[model samples]
Target: MILIGQYDSPFVRRVAIALRLYGFNFQHRPWSTFGDAELIAAYNPLRRVPTLVLDNGETLIESAMILDYLDELAGPEKALIAARGPQRRQCLKSCALATGLADKAVSLLYERVLRKDHPSQIWVERCEAQIGAVLDALEKERAAIASPFWFGTRIGHADVAVACALRFTGEAHAGVFDDVRHPALADHASRCEAMQVFREFVQPLIPPKG
Candidate 1:
C-alpha cells in the first residue's frame, strides 16, 4: 500500500497512525496537495491528502473512507471502532466532532495564509468560535471518561481522531488555542503523542503553498 500526503495534515496523520497501529506495512509518499497537485490528481481528482493506494491496485480517498476500509481489514475483534450499538454511535459522534474541528482549523489556515492580502474577518471569527466550541465539548467529554482511552483500556478511532485534531489545532492556531484551557484534551493528546506510533508518523506543520 502507498499512503500519499504529508503528515502535517491531521486527516493524513490520523490515517497514517491508524495504519501503523493496525500493523500494516506501506510506503509513505509525503506529497503535498499544493506542491504535488498533478501527481495526486492522477489518483484522486479531488487532489486530497490521505489517499491510500492498495497493493491490489485499489485506491481509497478521504480519511473516513480509508479508515472504514481499514477497520474492515482489521476485522471485528481488533477494529479501532466499536462494531455496533450505542458504543459505535458514541464513537462515531466523537470522531465526527474531532474531524469537523480539524476541517475548520484547516479552512482557517487556508483563509489566513492563502488570502492573507484580503482574508475575510467574518470567516476567521466564525472558524475561531467553532474551534473554541468544539474544544469545550471535547474537553468535557474527555474529562468525564476515566479510562485510559476514550472508549476503554484499548485505544480506538475516537482517541486517535481527537488527538490528531487537538495537535493540529494547537499548532496551527497556537495563539488562540492554549493547552492550559483544555486540560483534559491536552493530556489526552500528550499521552497519544508520547506513543511510538504517533511519534514515528508525525511531521511539523507546513502551510499550503499559495
Candidate 2:
C-alpha cells in the first residue's frame, strides 16, 4: 500500500500510525496538497492527504474510511475498533470529536494563512472556544477509559485518533492548548507523546503565521 500526503495532518498521521500499529506494509509519499495539487489530484479527487492506494490499485480516501478498512483487514479480534454495540458508537463518537477538533484547527490555520482577509473575529473566537471544549471533553473521556487506550483496555483506533489530533492541534495552532486549563489532557498528551509510534509521526510543521 502507498500512503500519500504529509503527516502534519492529523487525519493522515492517524492512518499512518494505524498502519504501523497493524504492521501493514506500505509506502509513504509526503506530497503537500497545497503545493502539489496536481500530484494529489492524480490519485484522489478529494485531493486529500492520507489517501491509501493498495497494491492491487484500489484507493481509499478519508482517514475514517481508511481506518475502517484497516481494522477489517486486522479482523474482529485484532481490529482497532469494537465491531458492535453502544461501545462501538461511543468509541466512534470520540474519534469524531477528535477529528472535528483537528478539522477546526486546520480551518483556523487556512483562514489565517491562505486568505487575503482575516476571518470573522467572532468565528475565530467560536472555533477556538469549540477546540477548547473538545479538549476538555477528551480529558474527561480519557480519564474514564480503563486503559491507556481510548475505549476498553485494548489499544484501539480512538487512542490513535486522540493522540494524532492533539499533536496536530498543538503544532497547527502554536500552543493554543494551554496546560493550565487542561491538566488531564496535558497528561494525556504526554502519554501519547511518550509512545515511540506517536513520536515517530510527529516532527514539526510550518507554523501558521497569524
Candidate 3:
C-alpha cells in the first residue's frame, strides 16, 4: 500500500498511525496538497490527503473510508474500533467529534492565512466557537473514562482520532487551545505522541505565514 500526503494533516496522520497499529506495511509519499495538487489528483480527484493506493492498483480517498477498509483487513478482534453494539457507537461518536474539531481548525487556519486581504471575522469566530464546543464535549467524555484508552484499556479509533486532532489544533492555532480547560485531552495527546509509531509517522505543523 502507498499512503499519500504529509502527516501535518490530522486526517493523514491518523490513517498512518492506524496502519502502524494494525501492522500494515506501506510506503509514505509525504506530498503536500498545496505543492502536489496535480500528483494527488491522479489518485484522488478531490485532491485530498490520506489517499490510500492499494497493492492491486485500487485507490481509497478520505480518512474514514480508508480506516473502515483497514479495520476490515485487521479483522474484528484486532480492529481499532468495536465491531458492534454500543461500544461501536461510542467510538464513532468520539471520532466524529474529533474530526469535526480538526475540520474547524483547518478552516480557521485557511481563513486567517489564505484570506489575508478579506478574512471574515464572523467565519473565524464561528469556527473558533465550534472548535471550543467540540473540545469541551470531548474533554468531558475523556475525563469520565477511568481506563487508559478512550473506550477502555485497549487503544481504539476514538483515542487515535482525538490525539491526532488535539495535536493539529495546538499546532495550527498556537495558543487557541487551553490545556487547563482540557487536562485529560492534553494528557491523552501526550501519551499517544510518546508512542514509537506516532513519533515515526508524524510531521511538524507548518502553518502558512502571512
- lDDT for 131 in candidate 1 is 92
Which ranges in model 2 have alpha carbons more than 4 Å from their true place? Answer: 207-210
**CA lDDT of each candidate?**
0.93, 0.83, 0.92
Lowest lDDT 10-residue stretch of candidate 3: 201-210
TM-score of every prediction relative to native? 0.98, 0.93, 0.98
Using alpha carbons, what is the TM-score of model 1? 0.98
User: lDDT by residue for model 3 over 1-210, one digit each (tens)?
Assistant: 999999999999999999999999999998888889899999999998989999999999999999999999999989988899998998999999999999999999999899989999999899999999999999899899888898778888999999999999999988777789999998898898898988987889988666
lDDT of 3: 0.92
Give the 10-residue window scoring lowest on summed lDDT in candidate 1.
Answer: 173-182
lDDT of 2 by residue, 1-210 (tens): 999988888888898888988889899899888788789998999888889999999999888889989999988888888899988998899899999999988888777777637567887888899998999898887766657666656668777788788878888786788778777667777877798888777657785444
Candidate 1 residues lying further than 4 Å off, grouped into runs, are none
In the range 33-128, model 1's lDDT, one tens digit per residue, is: 998989999989999998999999899999999999999999999999889999999999999999999999999999999999999999999999
**How many angstroms is residue 160 displaced in model 3 relative to the true structure, after the best TM-score fit?**
0.5
As a TM-score, model 2 comes out at 0.93
